[model samples]
Target: MVVVGSGNSGAQIAQELSRTHTVTVAQGRPQPALPQRLLGRDIFDWLSALGLLEVKAASPLGRALQRRDPVIGTNLRHLSRTRQLRLAPRIVGTAGRALITQDGGRLETESVLWATGFRPNYRWLAVDVLTDQGQPMHDGGVTRVPGVFFVGLPWQRTRNSALLGGVGQDAERLIDHHLSSPGPRRTP
Candidate 1:
């Protein structure tokens, strides 16, 4: 099997599958890899201790941090050295039964697993809270449409805004803003 987009999900999936099936990780670009632990402590502990996780997306430091998401937990380099799991170049195309690569190589796989990540598409919404680039037009999740708010946006308020547990922080702030608005605004 072949996995496309070697982010966290793809790497984890490929690692697990390598035990039962041959796996190829189609890496688009190399990302910095961080071990799950450091100095006998969880990597997150260091991040929290350094306050990196709460950095705002707009700050110079946060801007630099968001430029490339580091691959966490899994060591892709070690995995690539193993016969069952190998790293491949970006997938350029597919022809019949073969998956083509940017280097003009082709891989024949019985299955292709895509973990390409997510892109928020606001085009389907009838609301006018979208920018010309088709992204939600909001100031820290508070849309001009007033009553509407968005949580779980990447860097909505901070680096952790999109995380499952972290979203509550963003939600709490938006609710505070919503309640403070002069009056209810149901439309843009």
Candidate 2:
């Protein structure tokens, strides 16, 4: 099997599939990964305790320090080191059942799994809420429009804002804003 992209999804899929089949992962660049736990505590706990998770996404220093999306909670490095998984360069194209890599490498496989991530598609929105780069213009998910909010957006508040386990804090903040704001309350 051939897996394209090496993010969390790709890495996890390759890891599981390799147990029953020969798997090759094609990645454009090296992925950043961190263990689930460090120093006898969950990494998320450390982030929360140190207040790193609350850093503003729009901070100039944060932008300067930003790199690649990190993959968490996986043993990808060990899998590669033990030869349980094979990693390769980016996939350029496919010919029949053969997958071609950027460096002229090819893999003949019966299945090709594409684990590339996605981007937000706001083209259907008629309002001018997007920036020139096609990203939403908002301060930590709250837009200029009254009562309008956004959540689960990458870097909405911090690096983990878009992660599944990370959206809760942002959601709670949005709920608080909604409840505290002056408005006409309609009782259901």
Candidate 3:
């Protein structure tokens, strides 16, 4: 199988599939990776203790940190070293049943898994809260359009806002305000 991405999702999917099948991972670009643990502590524990995960998205420091887009934890490097997973360059196209790589090599695979990231789709929305870029125009999920709130958006309130473990905080903040605001309730 071919996994056409090397981010956390692709790396994880490749690792899982490697246990049963030969897997090749294709990277779109260079990425920095950090181990899940550091100095006998979970990396997220360190981030939480240092308040790095809570940094405001609009802050200069947060902007700088987001630019790195590091993969928090993965075993792909070790797996590659052990020959459990095969690494390849970006996949540019396909020639029939084979994948054409950026380096002009052709790889034949049974299937392909595209782990590329996603763009938010808000065309179904009927409100005016969308920005020119179609992102929800809000301050940490509090929209300028009343009663219209967003949660789980990338960096919605902090670096962890989009993570499942961290989204509860953003949700709590939005819920508290939403419940307190005197307005008609509309299902979201």
List clash counts for every candidate, in order: 0, 0, 0
Clashing residue pairs in candidate 2, if any? none
Residue pairs in collision within model 3: none
> Comparing candidate 1 with candidate 2, which one achieves the higher lDDT?
1
Cα error of candidate 3 at position 106, Å: 1.3
Please provide, for model 1 over 49-151, each residue's C-alpha lDDT reduced to its tens digit, 9 standing for 90 to 100: 8988799988999899888978889878888886598889999999998999999999999999999898878898888899999998888898888677888
Flag regions of model 2 displaced more than 4 Å: 179-188
Worst 10 residues of 3 by lDDT: 75-84
lDDT of 3 by residue, 1-188 (tens): 89998888888888888988888999977578888899999999998999988999999999998887778687677788875688898999889999999999998988999998888799789999898888788989998777789999988879999988899999999989988888798766
Error of 3 at 100 (Å): 1.3
TM-scores for the candidates: 0.93, 0.85, 0.90
Instruction: List lDDT for all candidates, in order.
Output: 0.86, 0.81, 0.87
If the candidates were sorted by their lDDT against the true structure, best first, what order would they fall in? 3, 1, 2
